[model samples]
Target: MCIYNNADPNSGIQSGGVYWAYGPHNLSNQFGNHFVMNNQYDGAWVELCTGYNGTGKGESIISAGYGFVEDLSPINSIALGTGNNYPCSPP
Candidate 1:
């Protein structure tokens, strides 16, 4: 996944890429709206969570090849992959 620092998709600059792996990658003080792109191949997906290590509330699912601009202030961590145990609903 490519995470952009800016919310505007047209001009958003990519902050970094998150590869597919078993994760709970924590965001360090990220705030405001940001652009997130899920570029994984196959049916891989990502989950944004409100707490660290894939815990907490307000989870969101992003499927492969999809993107969105959203307020990430409440999101503290991200998990990569697809499974039945994920807290968020399928996208």
Candidate 2:
């Protein structure tokens, strides 16, 4: 999910470039505040950027599993990689 500001992909704010992300977790520091997911991908990684039109410092791999970012930290520009590779069975 590529997050964009002003509802324009050309003006991206951040990205959730991963398979799936759940829960209330912070991505990392160096990212802008939450706005809207301008784009979403099903079978690919979401590329994150610090600015619009793919600008700013980029982090390709944010996580690899059901990952979570540091607590109380600034949200990162993007989160990458697949998720739920290993699902937990019923308790």
Candidate 3:
């Protein structure tokens, strides 16, 4: 149940950069990944994430645009959903 909205410039996301979310599902304990709309635009910037997918509200920049995403990381973790936990990083 991870979703992102890029309607506002104050969304804290990189103006035109792609966003990615990685984490485990609440009840299923499944891992998943989410990428923002990969549209072509000038002066695009993207923000990196940890727990939940979707760029947060702060520190944005022009999107440089990344292409062809393929990762096997989630295959070993859990899928993402509304019950996902942000900041999944271990301290």
Local distance difference test scores for all models: 0.74, 0.35, 0.29
Residue runs of model 3 more than 4 Å from their true location after superposition: 1-37, 53-65, 70-91
* Model 3 deviation from native, Cα RMSD in Å: 12.9
**Cand. 3 Cα-lDDT:** 0.29
On lDDT, the leading prediction is 1
Question: For model 1, how many clashes?
Answer: 0
Indicate the TM-score of model 3. 0.24
lDDT (tens digit, per residue) of candidate 2 on 1-91: 4333433445544444322453222344433333334133454334344433333444333332212232212224343334542121111
lDDT of 1 by residue, 1-91 (tens): 8788677767655555445566668777778888888888677777888888777774578888998886789888887875556754433
Candidate 3 colliding pairs, count: 14
Sorted on TM-score, highest at the top, how do the candidates line up?
1, 2, 3
lDDT of 3 at 88: 32
Better of 1 and 3 by lDDT: 1
